[model samples]
Target chain A: MRILVLNPNSNPEFSAQMDKAVEPLRFGGAVRIDCISLTGTPLGIETQRDIDAVLDPVCDAIAAKEAEYDAFVVACFADTGVASAREVTSKPVLGICEGGLSAALNAGERFGVISTSNEARNAELRLIRSHALMERCAGMEPVNIPVVEMMHSNELAERMVSAGRRLAAQGAEVVVLGCAGMTRHQALLQDELGIPVLDPVVSTAAMALGAIAGRG
Target chain B: MRILVLNPNSNPEFSAQMDKAVEPLRFGGAVRIDCISLTGTPLGIETQRDIDAVLDPVCDAIAAKEAEYDAFVVACFADTGVASAREVTSKPVLGICEGGLSAALNAGERFGVISTSNEARNAELRLIRSHALMERCAGMEPVNIPVVEMMHSNELAERMVSAGRRLAAQGAEVVVLGCAGMTRHQALLQDELGIPVLDPVVSTAAMALGAIAGRG
Candidate 1:
């Protein structure tokens, strides 16, 4: 199956990070994952305006590539343009936030989220509430890092470790990285925290492969 | 990662069927799945006595093979001996029921379970309640097929299709096969029902791979 993992930001670096994030999934070659950035959009999907600006472009990208892929993943923690993309394609459309949270449910009873910033944390909470999963959420903590600065900051992993510890202290059995930019830190944080840490990109890609395989 | 998929029952036929059920996962060859059965346990775990009977043996098997596998999967819908097995090793121990339910959450809002028998359906409901997932469950419909007869029956797929249709009619967006014995029918039922169908053996195996990969 071919899966298009669309990073709805204009930053090519973030798209490359997502591609590296799913490197482990490439070992089997049973599914192909192509991570690409949306052109003519914001560098990072941080603000509400950024999210609103990318909706049409995200849908248009999916519509344009609809015949080329079996499934699509909206690789943003905010889940930008997932519902609209689904309306335009018959194939499965997955949102990373939803994928990460759902995979956590299998790993543990209550899960925590490590958001990139306080604003992102609030958005994550709202998304959980929309899914009626508020009760299953242990808590959400932010590293106070902005999406644009995630790749360049060496302190990113340290901040994430601290946030993960707080969530672990709050009785979270699993920790979910709330932004696609945090994908590279999943293994390190998981090792330090001694619990399952979910990268939404990998989780959603796995789900997409399962969805494609289920199509039979 | 090497994953031991232990079928607690003594039925070799069931073990072979499970091996066939996970064939799609073999393509990548990144993770090795070995499906095996206990030698002296009951042919099928159907009653409370059967569940109780497998706990020690399952724990014993895990203890014996603790050094050999990176993860373990208890391939039974009833989740027989999972908690006990976890105590025997630090490696991930997964129950197929948990894996299937968690995957369903990623696939849709609410899910229906297709059970092998009425007794199994009751156990499934109790299991969902224990997980605090009763609210997310659309309902469970049984095909009234016994675990031992699941492989021999010609009507298995037809009955599953009927149950899946009932679930779809009741607003179930995804259907989970409540018994590991129903693994081979996942694709056909999903095609017939026009929704995602989760086979617990495959789902749990996927989770096991994720867990093993996360350890890096």
Candidate 2:
């Protein structure tokens, strides 16, 4: 089964980071994943306007590629264009945040999220309330870094560790990495914080795999 | 959103038990749930043959009634005909076992199933292994009672508590009721076992509500 992983932003480096993060999840399965960065958007999708600007392009890209893939993943933490994309495909379509939250719920009762920015944290907070999972959500902590800078910076690891520690202090039993760019930091954060750290990209990949398996 | 809860057996008493189990979950949402039992089936489905025999009839019932609801639930612990039902409709169709297992994952790191019999427990065990969640599943414990007798028997509560304690002894952090007929015992079991106890019907209702919310 072929799965299309869409990073709904113009940053190729971050998309590459997401691709690298999801590579290990393709174990012992007949699943092939292709990662693509949607162009003509901001370098990092940090605001509602950025998410809004890329929705149409993301939807078009998904529409154009639906025939080639068994499932589609919206890899942005904001889950930009997921509703539209799901409307366009008969195949399983998952948002990374949705997949992460689902897996976090599977992992523990109270989950916290480590995001790229406070803006991203607020977006996730809105989702938790909308999903009626606020009672189970510990909190959202931000790295205060640009999504693109997160891929190349050494400081991100330390920042993520600190954020994870803060979340753990707030009674978070499991921590979900809210941005695809932070996927590489999952194990380090888990080790430092002593909790199950979930990477959104990897979580979405697993959920997509389950969806495909269920269909089969 | 109007959700149809289909108890895929011909026992009105069991169906009524399931309906009572789900009433507390109908909290201030636009979600309206109606529970019904599928006719012309056994009083309870305890074997693979029973599960298989009910599939075509369940599918036919779902097909005949799909338009009148926003989502459909197959309220049997075996999750009989879920894939076929999903294939037949655009609306979200969930099996109680699937819903219960999903909620169990959300509730704790490792969950155990308290089933009505060894036969039901074996079916659930197969499901856990097949879903690649064997590591997360604590184990399945049997109450050693038939499904039909569970609702009316005075000894069921004590038997269920014993099964839950055995599961907890085997490292289950949460307990899942493996039969819809066992829903009424959830609160009591949770209190007696000192762990979160999940009722399949309530869990499925929440999932269905979320599915409908996502669609809107």
Candidate 3:
């Protein structure tokens, strides 16, 4: 099975980051992963216009490559245009946010979604409601960092450990690191929290594959 | 909001039947409904191949009309591509089976999905493992009447009612009408079953709208 991973942002760095993170799937013979960037879009997406701008081109790509792929993924913190994309692809398609959130439901009764921006937090708020995870959600909080900033922050590791524990204290059975950039810290965070720290990009890959080839 | 309902079968009679079943939503508010037939497909789908054959075109139409539609729906009895659809669309694309199952989750710890065809019943059996609904589902059964036979069977009502009672006795707080063609009998079955007789199509519409636009 071939998996098409569309990063809604134009950042090749971010897309490659995801490619590296999910490289195990390809190596493990799960599926071949292809990462494509939204060429004409802004680096950061925070609005409906940002969502629509990426949708048309991405949908066109999926339609054109329908037979070539087994599944499609909209890889972003917000999971933009996922519903519309699914309308076009017979292959399974997933949004990182929705995929991770849905997977979290299986992990436990309540999970915390840790994010990078107020806009990301707002997007999560709307998505969790639409996902009907409001009842199952422990809470959502911004880590007061940017996706790029986390890579260079000296305090990234310590801050994540502290924030995760706080979320656990507040009743989070699992902590979801909300950005693809945060995946580098998943293992450490999960170890420190002594609970799950979900990476949207990784989890969505698992979910997309599960949906496509009939593994649930 | 516009909800595009795709009856994924070539049976126009079944399509018209579903159209009437969805009439209540039209009077409810500012919602517009467009019910259409799958341009080329068999009279009914009950197998994996049927699902495979109808999925692309069904998904294509919805994707083609994404700009004009607020949401898209596949109105077949099996809800064949639901898990895959959820993976793709951010616009709340819904499958009746998934919706009925989710609604059943709310009504009871276990429920049974009742289909009109052997293939649909077989499909539901696979879906229990496919969608992870096995935990909440009592089991599923086929009434052994093809949808085309519904018009000729005067006992359809009584037979369906009896099936619901048997399922309830087996611990179903709700009964999922697995066939979209059977949605017209929701009220009749609900009254006699003494529990929620869920019409997958109607319940799916409600689930999608309620999840995305908020439940009024």
Off by over 4 Å in 1: A28-30, B28-30
Q: What is the C-alpha RMSD of each candidate to the true structure, in Å?
A: 2.1, 17.2, 17.1
State the DockQ, from 0 to 1, for candidate 3: 0.03
Ranking by DockQ: 1, 2, 3
Misplaced by over 4 Å in model 2 are A1-216
For residues A1-216, what per-residue lDDT tens digits would candidate 1 score against the true structure? 688999999899988988887776665566678999998898888877888899999999999999999989999888888878878997889888877787777677799999888887777778888766777799899988888988888999999999999999999999988887787888789899988888878877776766666565
Worst 10 residues of 3 chain A by lDDT: A207-216
Model 2: DockQ vs. true structure: 0.03
Worst 10 residues of 1 chain A by lDDT: A207-216
TM-score of chain A of each: 0.97, 0.95, 0.90
Quote the positional error of residue A111 for candidate 3 in Å: 0.9
lDDT against the true structure, each candidate: 0.84, 0.76, 0.68
Write down the TM-score for model 3: 0.53
* Candidate 3 per-residue lDDT over residues B82-150, each given as its tens digit: 545644554556676665565445344477877776676766778656655575677666667767666
Cα TM-score of candidate 1: 0.93
Q: How many angstroms is residue B135 displaced in model 3 relative to the true structure, after the best TM-score fit? A: 16
Candidate 3 CAPRI assessment class: incorrect
Tell me the tens digit of each residue's lDDT in model 2 across B130-184: 4445666888989988877877878889899999999999999778888877767
TM-score leaderboard ranking: 1, 2, 3
